[model samples]
Target: MAAKAFQPRHQSVSRGIAFRLVSVGCYSVMAALLKLASEHGVVAGEMLFYRAIFALPVVLVWALRSGGVRALTTRRPWAHLGRCALGIAAILCSFQALIMLPLATATTVGFTAPIFATVLSVLFLGERAGNHHWLAVALGLVGVAIIMLPGGPANDTAPLPGVAVALLAALGTASVVTVVRQLRHSEHVAAIVFWFFASSALVGGILLLYVGKQHDLQTLAILAGAGFAAGIMQITLTESLHATQVSILAPLDYLQIVGALALGWLVFSELPGQSAILGGCLIISSGIYLIWREYRPQTIARRNLEANTV
Candidate 1:
């Protein structure tokens, strides 16, 4: 039989975009909260450890609602654990970056996760990206250069280690995204997210033993808020995924720059220079354009495939 047409009857494309925007908004808020906590001297490991603790129960409920506990016991234990490790590393690096750099600048650099994800997908998943993606990659590199140039308006000597950590975070996160693609066919999204909290908690706790500082209840409460924010971000991300393809949702991730910039200015009194703003805009535009080019056709095809499957 011929395949059916791929049409989204329940949720319109605009709705999908709105959902993704909400998700990105949550992510930006979460990033701001993490940055705030860090300024008070919270170590990345400690911050993540607390965040994971708060997230575990919420994610557990999600896992149960999605597919019960069976979904958690996948045959691919190693893959899931590896993904969790990568997530922890990414959070650790990102928090470090946030602490050392201006909120807007650090966030702009960390937004490179999508590009890294694309490269990893091509290398590891054998996914074919067209010329537009390559062009996006090249332009993204230029954006990075603009942001990273020594003595640039956005440049800060303090963020050197943090910059390295953020790059490492990008690499690790890209690998996790590739792993997610590999497992998407078999694994439930909630299960993956659940493992993220569970594993990060356990691993981050172990790591925190070395660097953890004693904080009073009020400080602990603030740190715990980071976890709650992380949970909300994860839920938002998953819900957005349910409404649209990653490629469609990916561009919305750039909205974090706006939220971060605004929050940085309002809360932290930090402002992005003209160059930083211009470079961030170039990077975000290139990424969004590339994702749209690659995913628009593929999303249509996937919808058609689903219609036929039904």
Candidate 2:
């Protein structure tokens, strides 16, 4: 038999971009499925349970393929526990918001995660934000406020409770991102992902006992689909981050807003009001500018010089 050629693991910006877009599409689909299930009277806890349960097999397969079962082993159990708790809370709040708000509105509000993350980095990581960073953060907050402001045109308003929940979800997500930043120093990506799914499944399972409700087969299928899509999205996103610079991939995340807008209009007959569109633009522009600023060659060189001088 001929010898098989070994493939080298090399970064490909194009592939990373494609992977990111696919991941965004998968997430959009998952959100749509969750919304559909919610409409069928599925509780947020139950939806989370099924999402984690169905996603377990896929995450296991990913972990096994990335390394072996041993790759799932972790030395930082406490860190994972904290991350899982926050992640589960974020998921619960996100699901609740999705059920109550238009899809685009929920998604637009969720974009605040990066802005929250920036502030958290300053406070927790002792990282200093430049004037530009603070400017971006302020602009992003303004955008969030615009969306959350009361009494827009009738078609543009979302429930205050839903908006509040979504903002909470974004805060939780930012905290998760900050923790993951620390975890990446000590944990393999596969191990982190595996433990997250396992912990989430356990937590969701326990919660299910209290809040789970019966569902028709179709609703069950949709819930399962949501779980499956979430797993795929996670995998693709991980791969995308591995395959390219984060800045190259970061702006691509905004594509989800477009996907959500389209899905909302087509699937739910929901159109984002003026406030959402305006706020989304501000948030996305600020995020992209931050990413560009952080990744520019001059900024990179200056940071490296500072480190060397220190």
Best by TM-score: 2
Task: Give the Cα RMSD of candidate 1.
Answer: 4.4
The 10-residue segment of model 2 with minimum total lDDT is 1-10
Q: Which ten residues in a row have the lowest lDDT in candidate 1?
A: 1-10
Q: What is the lDDT, from 0 to 100, of the residue 163 in candidate 2?
A: 86
For each candidate in turn, the TM-score is: 0.88, 0.93
lDDT of 1 by residue, 1-310 (tens): 1111122335555677777777677677777777887777887888778888987777788778756777666767787877787777777887788888788888887867778887887887666777888889878767877776668776653245666676677777777777776666666666678888888889888978898888887777776776776777777666666665667677778778889889999989998876677667777877787678657877558756866887
Between which residue pairs do clashes occur in model 2? none
What stretches of model 1 exceed 4 Å from their correct place?
A: 1-15, 298-310
